[model samples]
Target: YEFDATVKKVEEAMLSEGFGVQLITGIHDMFKKKLGIDDYPKYTMVLGCKPQLAKRALETSLDMGLIFPCSFTIYEEDGKVKVAHVSIMKIGAEIGLADKEAMAPLIEDTGKQVRRVWDKI
Candidate 1:
């Protein structure tokens, strides 16, 4: 898909999966205009969040906010648009959450929703 199309699809997908797009950063444009580097491929970062899930995680651990507003990167590479996101499960373990079991559902659900967003595109 083209860059704009992919971005639109991703935003729509996130909304359908109960995640709201909090922000989008146009890395390619920023680098080109600010740093005067125009050779970079198109790239954008999408920040999304589900309020209830965020609330639940916060209740479990204030530190969880560090990973709040999950991010997805959409970039053009090899003439194709690709999407990627950090693994919440890995983050949960990395932060050494005291209640992994309690956070498992939120982590898994968030990951699944992200997958759904990818699938939609």
Candidate 2:
């Protein structure tokens, strides 16, 4: 997909997978205006969350709140568009923020949700 199409597709896919769209913003403008960088390609950040899942994770560990909103980055680099996501649940586990056994199911469910998002987009 092209830049705008990719952003739209990701928004629809995330909604279809039950994630609420928290924010969507172009990164190029921020970089250029705030940091005085002018040579960047198109970039967008998609912030999304399933509030129920976030609640559960936080109940398991308040520190999980640090990773509440999950995000996907879509950018153009080297004449190609790319999308990237790193699992917040897994990050919490690796960083010792979530209890291993307590968060296992949440991790599994969120992973499936992201898998569907990727598959659709």
Candidate 3:
């Protein structure tokens, strides 16, 4: 119930940010049977990709799949909509590629876009 309400909240927030939100709702069965997130509420992930920035990042590193687009997951936690981004900076650091100064700004910008979405919620 609250989870559904949260999607409305996120949708409103995304509209205010001038970014479109794509809600992935077809993975519930997979999550329950395969991923073992049975007790977890259905997950709604918003793919927030800025066109110019993403294109620039693509130009920067062809192998930059590690941080192509940013995503934030909204789920019910204690009857609240919890939004969180999957940080690519941390992933880059884990893989020892965080030192790429050229990619820093791109990654930061992606982070900012995702943050903007979360901020509105």
**Whole-model Cα lDDT of every candidate shown, in order:** 0.81, 0.92, 0.63
Which structure among the candidates has the greatest lDDT?
2
Residue 91, candidate 1: alpha-carbon lDDT: 87
In terms of lDDT, which candidate is stronger, 1 or 3?
1
Better of 2 and 3 by TM-score: 2
18-110 in candidate 1: lDDT tens per residue? 888999898999999999999999999989888887787888788787766788889999989898878654586567853788777777776
Off by over 4 Å in 2: none
Kindly list the per-residue Cα lDDT of model 2 for residues 1-121, writing each as its tens digit.
8999999999999999999999999999899999999988999999999988899899889998887699999999889999999999889988999888888999999898899999999
For model 3, give the 10-residue run with minimal summed lDDT. Answer: 20-29
Which candidate has the highest TM-score of all?
2
Better of 1 and 2 by TM-score: 2
TM-score for each of the candidates: 0.86, 0.94, 0.66
* Residue 63 Cα positional deviation in candidate 3, in Å, after optimal superposition: 1.5
